[model samples]
Target: MSQQDARIDAYIRKSASFAQPVLEHMRALVHKACPEVEETIKWGMPYFTYKGQLFCCFAAFKAHCSFIFWKGALMDDPDNIFQQRGENGMGQLGKITSLKDLPSDRTFIKYLKAAATLSTSDLPPATKKAAPVKKALEVPDWLLSAIKKNKKAWATFDAFSYSNKKEYVDWIVSAKTDATRDSRLADALTWMAEGKIRNWKYVK
Candidate 1:
C-alpha cells in the first residue's frame, strides 16, 4: 500500500464504528486494485483519489454503508451493480453491511482498477449542470401594499433571503389571471404575516 493508503487505514482503525469491518475491507480492496490511489477525508467521509481527482468514497450510516463512485453514472455496469441517486450523476452500490455483501474480490478489484484507468484518462462523468442563480425581483406595489397593511408580513419579507424573496414574487407574478394573482397575494401575505415563508410549515 502507498503512504496515503496506510494513513487512511490508521485513521479508520482509530475512528468510531458502525460498520468498521466493512469500510476497512472495502478500503483494502481499493488499495489492492490501485496501489497509487491516494486517500483523504472529504465531507467527513473517506474518499479515494487518483491522478489528483476524486475516484470514490465510502460512508457508514446507521444500518448500511454506501460505496460512492464519484463518477458512477458514467461507468459501464454490465452487472447492474450501481444504483443511481435521483437526477444527480452520483450513484451507490447500497446495503453494503459486510464483505459478503460485496462483489467477489476479483470483480471488485477490477472495477477499482477500471476507475483508476478512467481517471488517468481524464474522462469526467456526465452530470447535470447547476442552474444559474436567479436574481430577486422588485416587490410589486400590490404585494407591497399587502405587506404594509400587515406589519408581521412586512417584517418577514424583509428578513427573507434574495432567493426566498424571489420565490414569493415569482409565484405571484406567474399567476395567469388577475383574480388568481390576487388570491395568491392574499395567501402569501397571510403566511408572511404569520412570519413564515411560502412553504415554511412544510419545510423541515
Candidate 2:
C-alpha cells in the first residue's frame, strides 16, 4: 500500500485555484502507478520515493506547476513529453498550468511506473561537476607600490586569502579609465589600512 501524506493535501489546498487540480491529479497518478511508493516532503516540495531512492517530485508555483522525474535524463522518452534542457521549467512535462497541459492519463501512469522501476534498478551514478578553476591574480606595479608605501595596508594585504586579494586586484584592473583605476586603488589602500576587505560594506 502506498503511504499518503496529509501535508500534500494541505499543499494542494494552499496552491492557487488553477494549480490545485493539476497537482491533485498528478499525485493520484503517482500513487496509482506505484502502489509501494512512499510520500514525503523534500526541499519544501512533495516527493515520491521508492526503494529508498528518489522517484519523482512536483512543485507548485504561483501561476504553474511542474512534475520532475529524478532520473529524467536516463528515462526513455519516446513520446517526447520531457521538456527541452535549459527551458523555463526544469520539469519533465514543462509548465503545467492546467490538467490539459499534462499528457493522457495512461501515458502519465506509464511514466510513473517506469520512474519507480528505475529508482530500484542499478542505474548509472550521476556525473559529478568539476570544481571551477581559480585564475591567478596579478597585482599591478603602481598598485603594489602604493600599498607598499602604507605599512598597515601592506600588512593587511599580505595576510589576505587568495580570493580576498583577487577581489582588490580584479577591481583595480577592470576599471575602464586610468583615473578610475587610480581612484579604486586609493580606496583599496585606505580600506586595507582599516583592516577591511574590498566588499567590506556587504560583510556582516
Candidate 3:
C-alpha cells in the first residue's frame, strides 16, 4: 500500500506557507498514481523512487518550488512539459510558485504515472543525453619544459591516463598565485619522476 513518509511530512510542514500547498498537491498525486512508490530526501529535497532508481524529485526554494521527473529526459513529453535542457535547477516544469503555476491535476497524474512506468523500462540511451563532452587536456608549454628537464618525469607523464594528466594540469593551473603554481609544478615533477600519479596520496 502507498503511504506518506513522515520525513516528507516534516519537510512540507517546515516549508514556506505558500509552498506547503504546492508540495502537498504534488505529493498526493505521486502516491495516488503509484501506490508502490517510495519517498525519501535526496540532495536536501524530497525524491520518489520506483524500480530501484530516482523517478522524480521536488524542492522548495526561497521564491519557488522546483519539480522534476529524473527520467523525464527518456520519457515521451508529448505535452512539452519539460523545458529546454539546463534552464534552472533539475526541474523541467519551471518555477512553480503558486498552485496555478503547475500543470493540471490530470496532467500531473499522467506525468507521475509515466515516470513510474519509465523506472521499469529500459530508459533513454546515454548517447541521446544533452551532456557536454569533455575536451582533451592540453599540456602547458612551461609545464612541459619543466617535465622534459627530467627524462624520467617526462616518460612517466607520457604514459599517464588523460584523467591523471588532467589532475596534474588542473592542479598547476588552479593555483591562486605564481609562487603557488611554481611550487605545485616542482612538487608535481618530483612525484612524476618517481613514477607517481597525481593525487598519489589517495592511491590504493
Candidate 4:
C-alpha cells in the first residue's frame, strides 16, 4: 500500500464540504493504480511520486479541485480529456467539480499505467527545431500621436508587455471602417491614458 500523508488528511479535512469526498476518491484511485507511490506536499498541494518521478497531483481551489497526470502534456489523450478553460481552468482535465466530470476508474488507471511505463522507458527521438522569434509591435503614427498626448498613458503603453500592447494595436487595426477605427482609437487612448490595458475588464 502507498503511504498516505497526514498533511493531505488535514487538507481534505479543511477543504469545502463538497470537495472532501472528491479528493479522498482521487487519492484512493492513484494508490490503486500505483501501490508504491509516495506522497508529499508540492507547491502547497498534495503530489505523488513513483520511483522518484512525479506521478500525479491534486489541488482544491476556491470553486473546484484539480487531479492531473504529471506527464499529461506528453501523454497521448485519445479521449480528448484535457480541456483547458481560460488561463487557469483546472489544467487539461477541465474543472473536476464532481465525479461526473471525470472518466471511469478504469480509464484513469490506464492513463496512470501509461505514464508510469513512459517514465521507465526512453521517449521516441524527436527532431529539434528552434522556435520563431516574434517582432516588436509597430504602433501606427496616428495612434502614437494620440498616446504621446497623454504622458502617463504613453509611459504605460511603452512599458507594457508585447501581448498587452498588441491587444490595443490589434483592436484598432482590425476595425472594419474608418469611423469605427477612429472610435476604437479614441477608446483605446482613453483606456491606455488611464493606465489600463485593453482587456482590463477581464482581469481578476
Candidate 5:
C-alpha cells in the first residue's frame, strides 16, 4: 500500500495553475512506480520515501516544477535524461514546465525502481569530497625575533588566529628579494603592534 500526505494535496491545490496537473501526474506516477513509497512534506516540498530512506522530492515554482532524486549523482543514467551537473535547475531533469519535458512513463518508472533499489541497498549515499587539509605555516626565526623586540607586536601576533597569522607569514615568505622581505617584515610588525591584520587596508 502507498502512503500519501494531505499536506501534499493542499500543496498541489495551492500551486500555479500550469503546475497543478504536472504535479498531480508526477505524484500518481511515483505511487504507481513504487507501491511501498511513502509521502510527506520536507523543506516545504512533497517528498517520497521508500524502505525508510528518502526516495525523491518535487517542488512547484512560480513558472515551473522540479523533481530531484536524493542520490541522483550516484544513479546510472543510460537514457541520458539527467541534467548535466552545474546546470541551473535544482532538479536532475531541469526545469519541467510541462509533461513533454519528462521522460516516458516507462523510462521514468525504470529509474524510480533504480532509486528504490539504492535505498534498499546497504551502501551509504554519495557524499561530497572532503576538503584538503591546510599545511602548517612556519614563522621564520628572524621574523619571530623582530616581533619579539616589540612587546605590543608580539602580543598582537600571538593573539592572531591561525588564518590571520598564515596571511602575514605567506606574504613575507613570498617576497622575491631580501630587501622586500625586510621591508614587509617592518611593515608587518608595525601593523601587528597597532592590532591590525594583513590586508587591513581592504577591510571595510
Candidate 6:
C-alpha cells in the first residue's frame, strides 16, 4: 500500500462509525479495480491517482460522505449510480451513510474501472481545463507608497503568489472610502512584512 493509503486507513480508523466502513469499502474497491492506482492526500482528503490524473476521492463529514469520480461526467452510468447534483465536469454520489446506501461491490468496482479507463484513454473536454487564476485589483497609490516605504513588506509582497497578492489588493480596494483604505493599508503592510496573506491570521 502507498503512504497515502496508510494515511487514509488511519483516518478511517479514527472516524465516526458511519464513515469508517464506507471509506474502507471504497478504498478496497478502488485498489481492486486499479491495482496500479497510487494514493495521495489532496486538499486534506484522500485521493487515488492513475495515469498522471486523479481517478476519484472519498471524503467524510459529520453526517455523510461523498464519493467523487473525477472524470465521472464521461462515464455512462446505466444504473444511474452516478449522481448528478450540479455542474458536470465531475460527478458525486453523496449522503452515503451506510454500506447499504452504496451500490453492490461488483457494480461499484465496475464504475471505478470504467472511470479509470476513460481517464487513461481520452482527452478531457474543454470545460475540464483548469480555470485561470483571477488577477488582483490595481494597487492604489497609497498602498503602493506604503509598500515602497517598507522595504521588507515590498520584498514579501513581490514574492507572494498571484492569489495571495490578489487577496491583499482586493481587501484594501474593497474599502468604502479613502480613510478606511488607508487605515487597512497600515495593518496590511505589517502583515505582509511578516510574509502573511491577507486575512491569514483569521483563516482557519
Instruction: State the lDDT of candidate 1 residue by residue for 171-200, as single tens digits.
Output: 998999999998989999988888778878
Worst 10 residues of 2 by lDDT: 83-92
Considering summed lDDT, which 10 consecutive residues are worst modelled in model 5?
83-92
In candidate 3, stretches whose alpha carbon ends up further than 4 angstroms from where it belongs are 86-90, 124-204
Q: Please give, for residues 1-204, the per-residue lDDT of candidate 5 as tens digits.
A: 476799999999999998999999898888988999999997788999997898788899999999888777778999999985421236889998999999999999998989888877776666667798866669989878888999998999988888999999899889999999989999999999999999999999
lDDT of 6 by residue, 9-31 (tens): 77787778988988888888898
Q: Which sections of candidate 6 miss by over 4 Å?
A: 1-4, 85-91, 125-204
* Collision pairs in model 3: none
lDDT of 5: 0.87
Q: Mind giving the per-residue lDDT tens digits that candidate 2 earns over 1-204? A: 477899888888999999999998999899899988889998889999987888889989988899888877678887778775321244878888999999999999998999899878887534446797866678878888889999999999989988999999899989999999889988999999999999999989
Top-scoring candidate (TM-score):
5
Looking at candidate 6, the ten consecutive residues that score lowest on lDDT are 85-94
Q: Which runs of model 5 end up more than 4 angstroms from their true locations?
A: 85-89, 130-204
Q: Pick the candidate with the highest lDDT.
A: 5
Q: Cα lDDT of model 1 overall?
A: 0.77
Ranking of candidates on TM-score, top first:
5, 2, 3, 4, 1, 6
Q: What TM-score do all the candidates reach, one by one? A: 0.58, 0.64, 0.60, 0.60, 0.66, 0.57
Counting clashing residue pairs in each candidate, in order, gives 0, 0, 0, 1, 0, 0
- Tens-place lDDT per residue, model 3, 1-204, is 486678999999999999999999988888888888888987788999886677888989889998887766666778877764332374778888999988888988898998888777775522344687766678888888888898999999988888888899999989999999989989999999999999889979
